[model samples]
Target: MKKYTDEFKLECVELITIQGYPVRQAAEAMEVGYSTLQKWVRQYREEQVGITPKASAITNEQKRIQELEKQVKQLESDNNLLKKASAFFAIEMNKGGKSR
Candidate 1:
C-alpha cells in the first residue's frame, strides 16, 4: 500500500469534515481510493470525539461502531424518504377519492 504523510492525511480529512467537501469529491481530487478517504475521515472523527485511543490506534470495536453508525444514518434517511413518499401518495389518493 502507498503511504501518505500525516499532514496530507489530516488535510484530506479536513477537506471533508471541516472544509465541507464531500468525501467522494475530496477522494477524487486527492487521487486516493474512496474507501481510504472514508477511513481517514472516520479516524479523524473518532479522534475529535475521543473515541479513538490515539491518532493511530483504532480498535476493532471502534470500527464496528462506526460501521453501525453509518448504517443507522442510512436507515434513518431511507425511512424519511419512505415516509415522504407515503404522505405524497396518500394526498394524491385523497384527491382522487374526492373527485370520484
Candidate 2:
C-alpha cells in the first residue's frame, strides 16, 4: 500500500468536494484509486459535520474535535450508567423500608 501525505489527501478531496469534480474523474486525473478518493471526500464531508473518522483525520482541528467528541461520548455513557445505578439503589432502599 502506498502512503500519501495529508496535504495530498486534502487536495484530492478538495478536487471532488470544493472544485465540483466527479470522484471518478478526480481519481483518474490524480491517478488515485477511485474508492480511495471517494473515501477521502466522504471523510471530508463527515468532518465538516463533526463526525470523526476511524482512521487518521484530514485536518488538525478535526483531530482535536474528534478527541473531544470521543471524550464527551465516554462521559455521557458513564453518566447514564451512574443514573441507572442510582435509580436501582433508590428502588432497593424503598423496597427494604416497605418490607420492614
Candidate 3:
C-alpha cells in the first residue's frame, strides 16, 4: 500500500468533516480508499477528544446512539405540539357545547 503524509491525511479528513463532503466522495476525489478516509476521521475525532489515537475508535453503535438521540428530541417536540393542539381543540369543544 502507498503511504500518505500526515498533512495529506489531515486535508482529506477536513474535506469530509469540516467541508461536509461525504466520505465516499472525499475518498474518490482524493484517490484514497473510502475506509481509509473513515479511519482518518475517527482518528481525528479521537485526537480532538484527547484520547490516545490508537486506543480510541468510534463504533457504529455510537453513531446509532447519536441518531437515536436526535430522533427522541424530535419526537418530544412533536408530542408537545400535539398536546397544545389537543388543549386548544378541547377548549373549542367546550365553548361550542355551551352555545348549543
How should the candidates be ordered by TM-score, best one leading? 2, 3, 1
Lowest lDDT sum, 10 consecutive residues, model 2, at 59-68
Residue 41 displacement (Å), model 2: 0.8
Clashes of 1: 0
Q: Which is the leading candidate under lDDT?
A: 2
Across 1-100, the per-residue lDDT of candidate 2 in tens digits comes to: 9999888999999887789999999999999999999888888888888777888899777888877888999999999999999999999999999998
- Candidate 2 stretches with Cα past 4 Å from truth are 66-100
Off by over 4 Å in 3: 55-100
Question: lDDT value for candidate 3?
Answer: 0.79
lDDT of 3 at 54: 39
lDDT of 2 at 26: 94
The C-alpha lDDT values of all candidates are 0.81, 0.90, 0.79
Q: Estimate each model's TM-score.
A: 0.52, 0.63, 0.53
Model 1 segments beyond 4 Å from truth? 53-100
* Model 3 pairs whose backbones collide: none
